[model samples]
Target: MDDLDRKLNDAFPGYVVRKDLVKQVRGNAAVPSYVLEFLLGQNCATDDEEQIKLGIERVKDILAKHYVQRAEAGAIRSDIKQTGFQRVIDKVSVVLNEKRDAYEATFENLGISRVLVDSDTVKNNRRLLVSGVWCIADLSYSANEAKDESPYLLQKLKPIQMSRFDFEGYAEKRGNFTMDEWIDVLIRSIGLDPSQMGKRAKLFQLTRLVTYCERNYNLIELGPKGTGKSHVYSEFSPHGILISGGEVTPAKLFVNNSTGRIGLVGYWDCVAFDEFAGKNKRPKADIVDIMKNYMANKSFSRGIEQVTAEASMVFVGNTSHDIAYMINFSDLFEDLPTVYHDPAFIDRLHAYIPGWEMDIIRGDMFSSDFGFIVDYLAEALRHTRALDYSELYRDHFELSDTLSTRDKDGIQKTFSGLMKIIFPNKEVTTEEIAEILEFCLEMRKRVKDSLYRIDETFSRVQFAYRPVDGGSWVNVETLEEIDFPGTYHARDLVPLEGESVDEAVIEVAEDHSGTTVQEVSAERVSVPAIEEKTLFEGHKAYRENQRGVSFDGLFGDYLKGARRIEIIDPYIRSFHQCRNLMELLEVALRYFDYKAPSLEVHLVTGPDDYDVAKQRDYLDQIANAMAPLGLDFTYEIDMSGIIHARHLKIDDSWDILLDRGLDIFQKFDSGNAFAIENRMPEMRRVRQFEVTYLKKD
Candidate 1:
């Protein structure tokens, strides 16, 4: 085990389990992950290898004997009759047999019905009436002479969920792991490899869980399919339920006037709608109206009574059109049903997860490392819902005064949920608080920004915040604003006095391959550009899918007319990293005289610990290759282990700081001779990173 694995084991102890173990024990049992993990938590929670092997066998044996398969239900029934009683794992739902004036249970996959169940069981597990619950059930069969008497009997029943948890212990142990480690642990617990996701993507995945941990929070995610948008609500927790978009009704979601029985909102912590976006589909107006009220006021009207619920609402859907197409011609809410496209409903949403930023679910993304048993994590979150961390940031920072109460509520709920997930101990640094606060603002701002385009009466507000210690305000902008500037700026119906609307409008033509090419006119709207000094110096940021950025465009102006340059980047050890260094050097040579020996470059980098000799060989190859091109290249290892900054100094005139150095391009098919990105770096899709330029005194 690695350091992280050991720390997680020591901190969480028996509550942690290897995530890959679920697959080993899930053979043909069509059960949610939480159900499998509930069993794993009982048998295989320990870290010992022998114990885990034995637990796997024991679990397999239990499943084989108890788990019901529809194909073999008849054989199981025959076995039950032969044995008189048998325990089986299946979905159990209860209903009131009105004529008999008694409650009865039905095993969904076992193909058994009209089994006698006590009223106490129905009262305890009310969810059985809505979507049913996975339970371990005892069934017995007997021959009966009377036609009215049923032959099946339900001997016992137990829901497959965590019965108990220690919230205080969970909060205390959270101190052992840093925020980043905790985030990675949560990511691994969700069956994802943390190393394969970026910081933004990781936070986005964690944001999906906020609905489970917060009350009445509404969220929406619309993007391409296969991104696992609905996976968490469906499989991660027993306290949440996922229903089809078309399957939802006022009776199932809010309240049934006829029975006076509350619906999903009364039982589940979160109610998520799957495949929610379809322009052609029509939803009941009454359902939409009650949902809007419930989402905003946390209450719905049923007949003469008003009912309230704490369930958070989540909508996940697939967009038929890409982001740019929607931004230019329509809006982000384009794929939602006509009823849901209303501005009031859109404004009620606290956040809009940019699902396009997520990569499609791939096989290698699954983790084999140890993480908290999901049931344990689910219980921890459930307990945290009662605690209020919304005001945690008030002492450190303040939001803009122009934000409405609704906006403030949305931001606070999101921030509070993130704090509970990341820092349950309520301890954080100023920068840490700012990171989460800015993310919260951006999420809320995405919803508001779309509202502006959808409804003209919705005036815009600057989503900025100021630190209590007195510093320049930090303003947040949606990534779509930066990527589609022309479309974003053209949304205003009334142009400024000096600017023409024609100039702001840019036409985008998409080809058969779905590649967008923009055609801009000289006449355009004028908006205040973000101050470069505020962004480039001492401020950290991120950019994604940025194009037209090359070595010349990024650093050529700064490095021009310089005799010497110093490059201090610690990660230039691998072959691809060395190739990145060579490309930078070529860019430098293009600026200076190629035949001049005065232009010198020095690299201070860290050596590859696994193979120092190979690192030296690659650096030497770069030096030899550059010497022939009249550029003097020299490299040295930083033995002090303190050279962490990635920056370049050009003759003491400018300092260029880079978050990812020259290795910004994502992994591509470099071996393919026909690949354009292999030959031209400009053709590559760069990973999300940031670069800053600073001028020396």
Candidate 2:
């Protein structure tokens, strides 16, 4: 156990289990994570591995033994009768018997209904009775009930989530850990390896975490499929309810007019609509209008009565097109069905998470570190909704006057949500505040940027905003625009290194036997020149442009005496950033004589602001990739906390600081290895970047 693991264990001794153990016991239950974690919390919370294994086996046995399966419902009923009392797991729903003035539990799969439940159970666990619940219910025979009616009575039951939590204690305990430690704990507790996720990706994810804290907050995210947009709402919290987009109706979401009963909002803390995108899924316009109004006002009218609910709304969907393509050709809401594309409805959204910025779902992305049992975190967030944390940022900075009242509201809501997730204890600094502010603005800007491309009437206001205290206002545009304008501006290459290596050209040739030529390009060369000519025939012309350059030319002379090279880019932290670093190294290797002089590379880059462990993981991945080549590529995290500039250093004396560094390429097509641009180094698309060489004084 690391610092956090020990802390969590010490604080909640005998009640906290390693989060990953829950997943192991869950197997293929198709149940929510909270449900599995609840069982784990009850049985495997202890730190002993053997005890945990035994507990997991016991839980599995319990589920397999008593859980009602639709395929074997008849067998389960027999067991309940034969055993007299059976503990069964199933989706439990309840209905109020207004005529009898009592509540009855209904087991869906077991085909049992009206199992008399005590009033205390219904009143105390209203959440379980309100929505679907996975529970362990004690069954007993009740002969008084008719044969057609439920004969088995629900004697005792436990809801999956521990309803009661110490919110104040949770908040107080949060003060003990630093922001980084807290982030690590949160990531680990949720069973994720924080080391694998990137800072930007983590920030994007934490934005969603805010829903766990705030009430009536509306957020929407539309991007390519399989990004795990629905995962959090579906499994991260028991308080949240995830519904299929098409399956939900106004009655289920808002209020059921037939019974005058409030809908999901009255019960769930967070309600998410899954699979919300597509051009053909025709959602009722009236429903969208009602949702827009309810999202803004936190109230809805059902029949003659007006009802208010505190549920935060989340919409997740898949986009048919890439972000760049949509931004250039259509609007941000292009994936939204035409009926739901009204600007008024879109404007109701508080933030638009850049779904395109998220990586595709992969197994390696899951974290196994310690985080709050999500149900506990959800309970904490339910209380946090009442506490205002947005003012912390306002104390240091102010928003622009040009931002409309509605726009400011959107920004502040997002800011508040982030504040609650990252600094729930209210312990943060100016720099941290700035990062959250920048993120808030960027999220809102994603909405605005897409709007501009979609509707001609939408004004092309600067997707820009200013901070109060001191610093330049930033445009929420891609980094390519700021650093590699000459190249990304046109979204194409300008051939700055025309024909040869633009300014520092490297040339390679192959002999009849097809071996790499060792002679350097004559247009530009170091202090020394190569004398070989026989190896110069059948040479192919290539250019070292900003985006993706051919590695063959850069490493043609590695067989010489260049043994140690230093990479000094400032942006090698994220997975994509690491990929860029790997590409550069691959190019540098072409010059090495594999049989004789082996090459070694070293990297020094900036530390990630969101999480440091992820930075370390990226470096390790790079090292692993070069291990086979006998290349020793290592990285040391920059401690200066002020290196924003991107650059490169070779050996020790030769410094090649890049204006754009490695993250100069535009997003690739399909992100596949076999893509033409990905396979052909020279053809790979890249943004324009300036490389300047300096010698040691």
- Overall lDDT per candidate, in order of appearance: 0.84, 0.70
Q: Residue 240: error of model 2 in Å?
A: 1.1
Per-prediction TM-score, please?
0.88, 0.75
lDDT of 1: 0.84
**Candidate 2's residue-wise lDDT over 1-697, tens digit each?**
7777778776766556677676677765667777777777777777677988898998898778876778888888887787777888888999888877778888888888878888888777777656777788889875663554577877788877775778667767778787777776676666566665545556777888777787788889887888888988888887788888644778778877898877888988888989888888888766777788898788999877778888899989988886445533355687887777877777678888867666677677676545566667777777788877879877787776656666677778888888887787788888888777877876776565445434545543444455665677565554322322222222111224455444432222232234643543233223545656332222222111233354343333422345788766667888778877777777666666677556778777888878889889878978988888878888888879676776555556455556666665544553786788677765554443444555555
> Relative to the unseen true structure, what is the C-alpha lDDT of residue 205 in candidate 1, on a scale of 0 to 100?
95
The TM-score measured for candidate 2 stands at 0.75
Quick one: best lDDT, which candidate?
A: 1
Please count the clashing residue pairs in each candidate, in the order shown. 3, 20
Off by over 4 Å in 2: 1-4, 11-15, 145-149, 460-475, 478-697
In model 2, what is the error at residue 378, expressed in angstroms?
A: 1.7
Q: lDDT score, residue 292, model 2?
A: 83
Model 1, TM vs. native: 0.88
